[model samples]
Target: MVFSSESFLFLFLPVFMAVYYATPQRWRSYPILLGSYVFYAWWRIDFLGLLVLTTLFAYLMGQRVAAHRGSRQGRIYLTIGIGGCLLVLGVFKYLNFFVDSFAALWGTDAAGLGVHWRLILPIGISFYVFQAMSYLIDVHRGDARANARLIDFAAFIALFPQLIAGPILRYKDLEHQFEHRRHSAELFCDGMARFLVGLAKKVILADAIAPLVDLTFGASDPGFVVAWVGALAYMLQLYFDFSGYSDMAIGLGKMMGFRFGENFRFPYVSRSITEFWRRWHISLSSWLRDYLYVSLGGNRKGAARTYVNLLIVMLLGGLWHGANWTFVIWGLWHGGLLALERVTGWHQRAASYWLALPLTLMLVLLGWVMFRAEAVSDSLAIYAGMLGLNGFINDPLLFGAMSRESIALAGLAALVAAAEPKLWLIFSNAENKGPSGAVVSTRFPAASAPRAHASAALAHQNDGWTVTLATLVLGAYAVFRLTEQSFSPFLYFQF
Candidate 1:
């Protein structure tokens, strides 16, 4: 169930929290594991077995790899573990894509080739499989120790907060937390406040503009204005939607005393494609950098090999998202841009911030067309309209489809997305000011007291009662919206 759903917010979360806190410290992992499995099974019971078996396989292989460290056998075990995880992901996620492509090329039906049977992709298979592989690899590389405790390992893999959509926690980062965690009222309150902010982002912002996106994208021949409007809407929708999920996931982890790393920064404000990748989906980008790019020799291999490595990493990274040609093209598009930037030194060159910001955003917006489209052809069609190759006339139906609320909310979403960091700084600075226009100080010496005090006060205000009250109000509004609106699945869940 989604975090913004009524059942999740009102029923599952309360009950889960109650049971979780009631369980003793020694056996706390049991409830988390059980609750996680229940959460996954809520989507599809049959796939729950797949998740368990995969977890067991990874856990067992991790032990074997750890036992054989520094020998040929260790490398062999590592290869096998990695292969097994990829095989599972391949069969479930990419099998159909490969089969369909082969059939089309051969001018024959997939059934005739005995590959017509479709597999149901388990939700979060991409995320979990990657996690499992990283765990096995880290163990083999002697970067982390394999957990002998099956329950704790399983709990780490199936942690419901991040199981479905993730900030993609590394095993080393969370291994200790799984074994030992502390809980307190302050921590729990902070998590609740963060969760509420995420809920509002989804229910109030993303969902509000979704109908306009659906209407425009679903149109058979939306013209220039309609296509561009829809593209921008989808762009905003995606950020709030996926980032909202990440926020909820991180917030939930915090409540349970696990600190998942940040997944997003202000990516929209990036001045270059290089900077954008650094800010966006930070976990996945770092994963590709370390596991894929570094493994292929990284930038150590001179400029030519480095560009090829970047291309390969991004191509495979895109494929990891889904088994679609559109995703492949999307990856290639970014890879090409990144390569060009590296070769031309555009990334390092000084440019006007105003010029760079819009240029980067336009490029990103164009790329999103590929990411969001159902097929490569549809994406091209959208691009054509965006470039005004199609008529510039506005579609009346598309114009009428967007309600005033949708338009206002879309504008607000854009503003928030663009200025959120600055706004937060402003609020933080305001909150840090003391009575009588003086700055409060506790830790700093008299000379540097004001600056240090501002920093300390910002942190204090973040966790204070003001945040709690704001969370309550936003959470109540989200709940009301959940009851009134139709079910809106998270965009990243399909991946």
Candidate 2:
């Protein structure tokens, strides 16, 4: 169930938290495992089996890797583990795309070839599978030790907060917390506030603006005016939607005395695509960099090889989002820009903040068009509309139907996005320091993007009551918005 849904908010959360706190400190994972399983099973019982099997397989493989560390056996086990997990992901996520592409080559579809069955991808397969793979990789790399206790390892993988969508928790980052988590009223409250703020962002901003974005993108030819408005509107919608989900997941982890690291870090403010990837989906970017990019020799090779590495990493990263050409192209777009910036030294120029900011934003918005579209043709049409290849108001009904409420909310969402850095600084005067403030250190330097540790920062900034009071006001309003609206699944959940 989605966090914003009434059933989850009113039923699952309240009941789960009570049971969680009632359990003993050392045995808390029992309740966590039970509740998390129930939560995952809420969607489908059959899917729960895959999750369980994946957890068991990863845990066992990790143990084997750990046992054979630094040997040929260790490398084989690691490859087996990674390959097995990717096999599951590929079958469920990309099998259909491959089948269709093959059929097209033969001038026939899957049905024509008598391949009638279609696979249903389990929700969060991409995320949990990656987590499992990362566990084995880390174990083999000696970055993290394999946990002998299956329960804790199970709990780590199936942790419901990030089970469906994630900040992509790493065993290395969160392992110590599992061994000994500090539970207190203050941390829980900070988490709750962060959850509320994310809820507000999703409901009041993202969801509110979604109808207009749909109307625009759904148009036959939205034209210049509608296209730009829709693109900008969608840009904000996606940011709030995905980032809001990350905040909630992180906050929920914090509530449970586990802190998921930052996933987003105010990417819109970035002056270059290099900086943008560093901030946008910080978890995934860092993961690709550490595991795939570095594995492919990173920048250690010559400049030409480095540029090729960038393209290949991003191309795969884009495909990781979906089995769509649009996503592949989106990855290439950013990858190309990153390579260009590296060659020209534009990323480090520091002389063009005024010019860079808008240029970067426009570039990002263009990439996002591809990201949001269903097909390459759809994205190309949208680009044509934005370029006025189709005149303004070609699809009059779509443009005319856009409500003022959505427009206003779109504007408000942009305002909120702009004010994010300031918002974190609002309640306090102190420069924050350390993990107690909720940001964690990672192996990569770029992993240390300035986090939107809003609730954590705010709670620490204030004299207690103010944080509570402010959160209450925001939470109540966000709840009102939630209950009044139809269910809107988080955008990232599809990934």
Candidate 3:
């Protein structure tokens, strides 16, 4: 079930949490694991077999890797085992795409050369595949211990909070938690507030702009102004959709005493493509960095080889995102920029905030044409329209083009979210900083108190009555929006 669905929010979550907390301490894991399977099976009952098989295979492989530590044969066995998991993912996810592409290029139907069975890709196959692969590799590398308990290993892969979509938990990071986790009132409350904020973002801001994006970009005769606005709307929709989902996953993990890492970090604010990558989809970046890049010799190689390695890694990373050529092009676009930055020392070169930020955002926006379009030609058409090739004055009366209220509200929301006024900053920052606050205070004593004090002062800047009234208004707004919209599946789901 989708996290945003009424059935999930009003039914499944309540029942699950109630049983989860009420279960005996010794038996709590079973209830949580069972609840997770129920959630996964909501999408596809057949997929559960893949989940179990992969979990069992990874666990056995981990034991073998740990047992034969320091043996070449053991290392090779681990490689083959990990390769087996990837082969399953490749066959189910990409086999059809490969066949179709080959057939198109050769002017022959490649499907005729293969089995007739069309595999339905199990939801979250990409996520679990990477998670399992990471666990086995870490065991071989001596970074993590083999998980002997099959249930614990299965729970690691099937953990509901991050199961459907993920922040991509590393085995080493969560190994301790599987052995020991304590639920507390503070953590639950913190998690509730975080999940609520993300829910609000997705239901309120992103959902509100989605119709405009659909109307404009989905239009066949769209003009330049309409195209730009549509692109902007989609960019926002994508962020709040994916990042909002990540926030919910992380928040739910906290409530269960499983800490998944942050997956997004205000990537929209980055002034360079390289910086943007660092901030965007952080978990995937780290996963690729640690596993693939490091395995490929990382920066240990000379500059030229390092560039080649980066290219190879990114191309694979891009392919991992989807079975489409557009995603590959999107990955190559960023990879090419990164390579150029390294060679020309442009990474160190800084432009003014005004120039650099907008330019970088434009580059990203143009790239999204490739990402969001149905085909390469569609992407090119959108680019041409966005460049005013179809004329810029098409939408003379903006209010007439879209309803006056919609344009105003979308513009205001964009400004507020993008500028991130003090109140919004304080709310999101303080909410997420619960456990990390002590570390922050200890490391930056001089800045910590003032920051909190400034936030408090801003809270009181408006009269208490006015502030309370605004909160009520926004809360009402969120509730109204939630009631009107259905769940918007995160864009990352296609991966």
Candidate 4:
């Protein structure tokens, strides 16, 4: 079930938390594991078995690999384990794509080939498969020890928060947390704030912009301005939708006493493709770097090898995001840009931030069109429209149909969201200085002893007034949106 759903947020989470906290420390893992299975089972009961079976198989193979480490047999087992994971991924996710391609090339109906198997991809199959493969490979590489306990290993793979659309948690990162963890009131409160903010971003901002995107994409011969509007709205929608989900996942992890890493680092503000990768979907980038790039010789090799490694890593990275060819091209697109930077030593020569930043953002924006498109031709068509090749915006009907408030809000949200880091920094610095930093405050500087003065003034703002007001506003908006049946599934769930 989606974390944003009413049942999940109000019912499932509260019940899970209650049981989780009530369980004995030693047996805590049991309830969490069972709860996770129930969550997955809500999607498809049959798929839950696949998750359990895959976890068992991978965990067993991981132990075998760890035992045989540094030997030919160990490598063989590792390869076999990885291959098995990929084989399952391919069969469930890529079978249709492959069948269609084969049929087209051979002029034979793929359905008549007798090899066609209609498979319903288990929810989170792609994510957990990658996570599972990473575990086996890390064990083979000696980066992490294989867990002897089957339950512990299974929990690591099936952890519900990151199971569906993940920051793609690494085995090594979470290995210790599986058995040992620290919980605190402060972390729990902070997680609530983060989760609320993420919920607002998705339900409020992303949902607000989605219809514009849907309309633009759904049109026949979309006008140039309409296409640009659609593409821009889509870009905003994607960031809020995916990043919002990531935020919720991270917050849930924190509340559960698991410290998952932040996934999005304000990637919209990145100044280069390389910088963008470092900021966006950071965990996945690091995963491919450590597991794939390093295994493929990494930067320890010369420039030639590094370039080849980057391309291969990116190509697979794109495929990992989805089974579609567009994703493959999206990966190659970034790979090519990275290669260009390497060859020309452009990354070494820092251009003016003014020039470099927008250039990077534009490149990224264009790339998103490709990533969002259903097919390569649609991407090209949309891109052409974006460049004003299609006379979309001149149509008065589109403009007149859109609410001025929505248009204004869309523009404002994009600008404010892009400036998120600066905004957070501003509030943070102000916060450290005490009540003096707050405008229209009741207390003046040095009205009393420093700590006491700060405490009294801080009490005014922190008395749940601001939080209650914010919550009420957001809750109202969420209810209105929910009533309208305007919920949009998170973009990254497919990954």
TM-scores for every candidate against the unseen true structure: 0.93, 0.93, 0.88, 0.90
lDDT of each: 0.85, 0.86, 0.77, 0.79
* lDDT tens readout by residue for model 1, 1-495: 878887888788999999999998878899999999988998899999989999999999999999999999989999999999999999999989999899989998789788757988899998999999999989988888885589988998999999998878788888888778878886676577668778888999999989878876776667888788889999999999998898899779868877778788778989999999988999899999988899999999999998999899999989989999999988998999999899988888725556888999999999998998898888888888788877785577667877989989999999999887875444333334221224544355567677787987676666555645666898898889889999999999998
The TM-score, computed over Cα atoms with residue i paired to residue i, of candidate 2 is 0.93
Clashes of 3: 0
Candidate 3 residue lDDT tens string, 425-454: 455444435322332221333556887877
Total residue pair clashes for candidate 4: 5
Residue-level lDDT tens digits of model 2 in 200-247: 888889999999889878877779999999999999999999888888
Q: List candidate 3 segments past 4 Å from native.
A: 108-117, 351-354, 393-406, 421-425, 428-480
lDDT, candidate 3, at 197: 62
Lowest lDDT 10-residue stretch of candidate 1 = 428-437
Report the error of model 1 at residue 230, Å: 0.6
Residue pairs with colliding backbones in model 2 are: none
Kindly provide the TM-score of model 4 when superposed on the true structure, using C-alpha atoms. Answer: 0.90
lDDT of 4 at 376: 85
Candidate 1 vs. true structure, TM-score: 0.93
Candidate 3's displacement at residue 356, Å, is 2.0
